[model samples]
Target: MLITGADLAAPALALLDDYEVVFAGKAPSPDDIVALCRRHDPVAIIVRYGKVGAAAMDAAPSLRVISKHGSGTDTIDKAAAAARGIQVVAAAGANAAAVAEHAMALLLACAKSVAVLNERMHAGHWDKATHKSMELEGRTVGLVGLGAIGLRVARMADAMGMRVLAFDPYAKDVPPFVQRVELDAIWRESDVISLHCPLTADNAGLLSAATLAACKPGVIVVNTARGGLIDEPALLAAIRSGQVAGAGLDSFAEEPMTPAHPFHGEPRITLSPHVAGVTADAYVKMGVGAARNALAVLHG
Candidate 1:
């Protein structure tokens, strides 16, 4: 067994005690991961973070399963795994509350300009508090996906007196509080837009310059999903033009290397190191889930 990209703590990882669980360091690129597979020929690959492409699949001759640490498997190529009879499983809904809470925190921080205000205070400037801050109460929030995390966010927004408009073509049994609306309607009416969708070929670059232009001016965007879901250049431009009031982003095209990131100095965006679903509680659940999934595939 091999664990790549991120840490999987001892307790849950102990489930694979019968096998050798190797941790190949952190922040390795897709090619690096494939090279590791070429050398190790691990029976199972637990992709906690980063990509597992066709080349990686080709490199793993002994691979029987590919287990994802979290809900979204966008970074792993499903087709490549399928071609080699590799079973791919993910720990869905295990980290829903953690991700939902992080999204809400981002929303609140942006609404209150927490990032900007804190910097101002540290810089010895104190006049910004008098400025108006947007409140969640009574504002319409559009959620791009209605998965477990999205549903959790919907429930939380309801408690805060915010209307939730969710768009999910395949979603069913949506609660009465959330209005299932078309994607265009969300762009037209939402004061805040939150993304909870996985990255797919059809939805990659979903929030491009054209779509951002269609959105209500000064709309606040919060994305905890894939970075490719939003065009970084377009988002940066929108922020500069004030078309986007602010953004709370937990993912990026390039991440875990924040010092040279473009969003590092941008006050209009509140950034996180993709740790939204990495709470202590979620980590255990994800690790145990991945271990069981891999063992199931190996035994079957």
Candidate 2:
């Protein structure tokens, strides 16, 4: 069996004892991937969502299954795989809790001004009362998508004494604590806005300048989901104009953000290296799930 992407190597290896595992040195080009597959002719291919492309599929005629290590299949060409009779599967819901916890961490960090306060302390300046910190209690949190991760965030926010309002077109009945509302209401009424939806063509720039303008002034925004969901330029402008009080972002439209990125210099923003779902526990669960899915397809 072949596994692309280094992030999935260790956990996948732990779950599979019978197969001889081969790891690509780096994200191989389409030609390199096809060449490797022609040489190996493995029964199954496991790859990170964004690393594989059409060339790899055209190269490997023997490939039966393409398993994704994570939930998002944005990087994979599903139509091509379907045409080729290839089965695609993902380890969905494996990292929901970890992601939800990380989202809340960002929210709390923004609400309490954790990054700014830490900087002040490091500078040897005692300014406790200079920055006013608000508690999560009595705040209204609007969740963009009430999937597993969003539902978990809603529960946590409720426990913290925050009223939870969620907007998900697919959700038929929300939990008791969460009030299901329209998308416009979520945008206008939320004190803190937490995004938990996937990035799609329809929702790619869901939080653009126009939408950000509709948000309540001084709104604290948290995005642990994909970065393209929020328009970075709009977010930067909102932060500068004081329309957004603060932001917590774990993902970016581009990875390994450039040093010249506008959000880099913004003290009101807390950034993470796309690590919201990278905890040890989540890694193990996802790895095991991927391995099991691959084995089931290969043996069936």
Candidate 3:
């Protein structure tokens, strides 16, 4: 077995005690992965970072399974793996609590201007007389996906006395508090729009300039999902023009964002280093799930 990152959680490592495992170091590039595959010819890969494509698969002819560390498998080339009879699996819902909590935190931060207020206090300025935070008690929150994370978010929002609306065609038997709605309704009536969907070919730019324009003015946007879902340039323009009151983002179209990125100094946009699901507990859960999935395939 080959693990793609620097290390796996100790609990997960314990599960693989009977199997020989190798680490590919931290932040391995595609070429690096291929080189490691050629050297080790691993039977299974527990992917924690970097991508696994046809090149890497071809190098390791014995490769049988590619298990993702977390729910999203967008980084892996599923089509390529399929062609070679290599199975691809994900630790689905392993980080649900962690990610859902992060989404709620982002939504709250954007709604209340928490970051801006903290910065103002540090600068020795007080604008309490002029500042008014938006209250979320009665506002509506629209969720793009109703998966494990989204369902938890909906429950949290509902507890805060907010109306919950979700748009996921595949979701069934959702909580009564969450109303199933169309994307149009999400744009038209939601005061806050949160994305929890996967990044797919058809919905790469789900929230484009046109979609952003259709949203209610002063809408707050929160995305803990893939950044490709929202067009970055269009989002920046919307924020600049005040169409989007504020945004809380945890991911980007490109990972390890460059220092010169446009959102670097933007006050209205709050950014995180794509670590929404990186909590200590979630790490162990994801790691264990990934390890078990790989073992299941290798033993079968």
Candidate 4:
């Protein structure tokens, strides 16, 4: 067994007691993973972070399975793994609560300008007389996915008295409060839009300039899913032009966003370093899930 990151939860580590586990450091480039694969010839890989591609797959003739630490498997090359007869699996829903709560926090922050207010207060200024926050009640929120995390977010929005509209062609058993609708309805009618879908070839840049333009003016955008789903430049421009009133983002097109990134000084944007699912409880759950999944394939 080989782990892609420096650490895995101790409980998960216990599951691989019979195998020698190798760590690829905190941040590994593609070459690092390929080198480690060639050297260790690990039979299974638990991906905590970084991409797993064809080069790494070819390096490890003994590799049997690639398990994801979280729900999203976009970082792994599924086609390459399948071609080589290597199985791919994800710890789906392990981080649902953690990520759902973070999405809600981002939405609330954007709607209420929470970060802006905090900065203003710390700078010895109060805008109580001039500031007004958008009320969520009775407003429509459009969700792009209805998986575990999306379902939790829908329930949260419903509890707040917000009308929830969702677009997920494959979703079933949707709650009564959520109205299943087409993607066009989501764009045309929502006061707020939240994304909880995986990044796929078909939906990459789903929220492009044209799609952003179709949204209701002053709409709030929240994304806790893959960053590639939205065009970064288009989102930046939308915020600037007020096509998007505010944005709360937990992921980005690039990880470890550069200090000089365009969003750095943008006041209307709330940013988190894609750690929405990194809570202590979630870390353990995801790690355990990944370990179990890898073991299942290997033992079978």
* lDDT ranking, best first: 4, 3, 1, 2
lDDT of 4 by residue, 70-112 (tens): 9999989999999999999999999999999999999999999
Candidate 2 runs further than 4 Å off: 7-11, 26-35
Give me candidate 1's TM-score against the actual structure: 0.94
lDDT by residue (tens digit), candidate 1, 268-298: 8998888899899998888888888888889
Residue 250 shift from truth in candidate 4, angstroms = 0.8
Q: For all candidates, what are the clash counts?
A: 0, 0, 0, 0
lDDT of each: 0.89, 0.85, 0.95, 0.96
Evaluate model 3: give its lDDT. Answer: 0.95
The candidate scoring highest on lDDT is 4
Worst 10 residues of 2 by lDDT: 46-55
TM-score of each: 0.94, 0.93, 0.99, 0.99
Worst 10 residues of 4 by lDDT: 250-259
Greater TM-score among 1 and 2 belongs to 1
Model 4 regions more than 4 Å off? none
lDDT of 3 by residue, 34-137 (tens): 99999999999999999988999999999999999999999899999999999999999999999999999998898888999999999999998999999999
